[model samples]
Target: MDVSFLGGPHPQRGVGVVAPFDFALDRELWRWVPAEVSLHLTRTPFVPVEVSLDLARLVSEHETLGDAVRALNAVAPEVVAYACTSGSFVGGVAGEKAMREAMTRAGALPSLTTSGALLDALTELGARRIALVTPYTVSVTQSLEEYLAEAGITVTDRAFMGLTRHIWKVPYRDVADMARRAARGHADALFIS
Candidate 1:
């Protein structure tokens, strides 16, 4: 018998991520993927608009995301994903569909977004009431709650740090505390938005 194997990050599959210019959790995202999967990333232009309406407008732009998806397609990834939650959810369910359609049309591959994925996950878990946790301002976090409500998932409780800058600086212990607080209610599941 012959046995053959190689060591050190054998990337057998590639996933393209169309991300925001300010996305800072690259390491966290990579950690969730299997070692056999490689990530190809392209960033869309982002203006510094922290307000809910302005930020929604900035992220919901199909043209910007389409260009980014096309660029990622040059790498021939098996799938493309829009990694921004706010951008994906701001337009509601219909808008999310359009965003996915645009990405697929641009790259000729399967496409999804963070918000869409979240909805799928929640449904798969049969979670009816969710405790929300976020590092965004109250207004932005409330918008997320509203989006989830549109999907018929009730929010039992929520925690927000009201942060707009230096999100990377938040301590894990603090996050854990917030999570604990959010889980205090009678929620079926916890969602960190």
Candidate 2:
């Protein structure tokens, strides 16, 4: 397995990076996903929602998926990840499917979304009942909860901050606080994903 990093030109942007608020905690686990000959990353931090021209609003979807595809194709990466959770889930299945097709059409590369990875990990862990925590608005959080439940996992508890932008502004203290709540009782697992 191989991995390469891409982001801004400055030292703060590229490899050995630590996002202020990474929806995907400890991306180090993806050590096995990269390859020597096929690695392409772009200087675009994974933001779940973007300015959607069609919708004329900042929706929880990947409007820059096209940019992602371009970056992948330009570098010819065999495997790539969009690296946003709520955005991918916000897109729901359809939006994700669109991303796959978009990547295919642009460079014929395979793409992965954080949401998809979460579902896979959840299944592997046999997590039937789980708790969800995020800094999204009530509407977005509710939608995410509904989506997870539809995936055959039961969300016993949920917490949201009703936040829209500056997702990194969410304090770690709050996340830790929620972790405590999510782990209080016995549920299959607590999904910080």
Model 2, range 69-90, lDDT digits (tens) per residue?
6655654455566555665666
What is each predicted model's overall lDDT from 0 to 1?
0.85, 0.58
lDDT minimum window of 10 residues, candidate 1 = 1-10
Give the clash total for candidate 1: 0
Compose the digit string of candidate 1's lDDT tens values, residues 56-130.
Answer: 658668898889988987889999999888788888888889999988898889999999999999999999999
Report how far off residue 90 is in candidate 2 (Å): 1.8
Evaluate model 2: give its TM-score.
0.67
